[model samples]
Target: MGQPIFYGSVHVLFYRNDEVLLLKRKNTGFMDGMWSVVAGRIDGAEEVVSAAIREAREEAGVDIDPSGIDVVGVMHRKNTSSEWIDFYLKVKSWKGDIVNKEPHKCEELRWFPLGDLPETVIPYVKSALARNHDRIWFESFGW
Candidate 1:
């Protein structure tokens, strides 16, 4: 086989009432203790849209209404591993209370205003949030 087919991931940016949802990673993994949006790898035969919805439900314990989330453009990121991130904008109201179910993967989950976000946010995610509604990428990291 040639170069391995890169796997894509779906990321959801759920913003409401001037606050955005972020989770602090706790377990041992890449970017642990960092704050990030609900993201998950897209499984084979699974569409990115469904992945986004599933991730939000599983990670944040939020049931997203299908009619609400909108699929945004894809983001191509080339680091140690190259990937095409399928971006989705979920602005609709969701049911169920927010809970940090996966403490191993996430320590705490909370919403913060855009202007006063925590410093532990994943750098790439921070850039993405800053460029919400705009396709222009403002930053890049080799690693």
Candidate 2:
């Protein structure tokens, strides 16, 4: 036996009023054209919450305080090649104007009503958000 290998990612949801920020994925072969929140793979030796803050800034050009982030849910998923552990975080506050910092990787950034997200949202992302946070501490997909 060997050590288990799982790729970890962090996602942050930025909300204003009744809307949540989402980005249209592009050029990323995994889920091109799908809507997703600000997210990225965790870098080496970085904490999950820190990764969430970093991703929010990197993807949306916003600065988020650590104290304003809340861990909402986690999803453990598997594709044909590998496993993933995705941490979902909700941001209570942030600074700076939100913009698409990575135009090449993202097509556009927009805000959508939390209750009526776009039909093209990534399946797991939609599933995670639709469920009550307290009811879904962890989720598994493509087992």
Best by lDDT: 2
lDDT of each: 0.75, 0.88
Q: What would the per-residue lDDT of candidate 1 be over residues 4-121, giving only the tens digit for each residue? A: 5566877788887889999887775678878988887888888766777788888888888777677754565665656455464654667888787777788888899999999889
In angstroms, give how far residue 1 of model 2 lies from its true place.
Answer: 7.9
Assess every candidate by TM-score. 0.84, 0.92
Instruction: Give the per-residue Cα lDDT of candidate 1 at 120.
Output: 83
Worst 10 residues of 2 by lDDT: 127-136
lDDT of 2 by residue, 9-51 (tens): 9978788988889899999888999999899999999999999
Error of 1 at 42 (Å): 0.8
Which regions of candidate 1 deviate over 4 angstroms? 1-4, 134-143
Q: What is the Cα-based TM-score of model 1? A: 0.84
Report clashes for each candidate as comma-separated counts: 0, 0
